[model samples]
Target: MTFRRQVMIILRRDLRIEGRSGEAIFVTVPFGLVALFLIPLALPLDIELLARIGPGMFWSVTLLFGMFITFRQSAAESSSQQEQLRMLGVDPAARFVGRAIASALLLLIFELILAPTMVVLYAPAAIPGWPAIIPLALLAAVGLAMIGTLAADITASLRSRSALAPLLVAPLSVPLLVPAAQGLESLRTKNGIMVPTMFMVAVVLALAVAGVVTAQPLEETT
Candidate 1:
């Protein structure tokens, strides 16, 4: 198969798997909602404080969801599964591209739905402009997807790797989470997304490069 075709095939397969299972709806979305719901109960009920913390909380929940999806998706590729794919002559590069695409697509969908819900739940004083968030969210999703996928790949075969995956991803994802959180906060405060959005674009580029370079190594290790 052509490289692009291989990537598309895997992408479609992952998407189909996710769709038929309704895992995103039943598991992922509900998990996010539960996390979000707990924030109010866990923290003080001060409205202004909640509003101020809203953006940070929103991205934090997204991060946890991103990690959850990564861990689950990576679990799909057990050692036997990797051997099967390799025997079928799947290119590691194409596999990475396909996984990154599916991961980002799912994360984007989650954020799109969750963002509005968060606005309604916490930001009652002002409706943040949705347009400004588009570029930020898009870049953030891709960054999270790529980073999480790579982390999952790295830890997939190790003993206790399920427990290890998030630890590996957390530090690498600092660049992603920090900028996104700050940018969202900036959006809330200054109504501007240009600065942090630009930083996120850079982050996406860096992670994309890292994904490409590491895909083959990851597959080999798996």
Candidate 2:
């Protein structure tokens, strides 16, 4: 098969699996909802307070929830079937790209739900600039997907890989977390899409490049 075909195969496989399951809708997104619901309660019910901090809190929780699903997505990439893919001569790099793309798309959907959910729950005053928010969110979702998929392989062989996935992925994801939170916060503010947006895009691009370069070795090592 051609390289694009290989990537699409994995992408379709992962997307189809997610569509059939709705695990995010029923499970992880609710976990994010809990985080969203709690922040306002824990902080104060003050509208002003919520408006100030809600964007940051929303993105942080969304990332956490996204990472949770990311582990599951990468875990599915393994087993006899994955070995079979390799045996068939699908480039390991292509497989990574494909899986990352699928996982990124999955994460993207998950975030799309969580964003509005946050707005509903928190009711922040400075409405997010939808134009900037879309790309910012896309970056955050895909960046998390790439980073998490690559990290998942580190502990894939371990019996404890599920538990270990977060531990492995979280530190590396600090760059994503910082810029994402800041960008969302900025996007919600009057200045709109400026420095933080650029920072976030830069970080996502860096992670994408790094993940692509390292994906094969990481897969092999695990």
* Candidate achieving the largest lDDT: 1
Model 1, 1-222: lDDT tens per residue?
A: 899999998899888888887676568878998887889898887988888777788888998776667666523676788788899999998888898888888888889878888887887456357467677778888898898888878776678887788888777887888878776567667758787888889989988888888888767641
lDDT of 1 at 126: 60
- Total backbone collisions for each predicted model: 0, 0
Highest TM-score, which number? 1
Q: For residues 1-222, what per-residue lDDT tens digits would candidate 2 score against the true structure?
A: 898999898788877787788775567777887888877777755887787777788778867777877777433655788679878988877877887887787787778787788777767775545566677777888888888777766666678877788887778777777876776556555666677668877887887788778867765633
TM-score for each of the candidates: 0.90, 0.88
lDDT of 2 at 141: 82
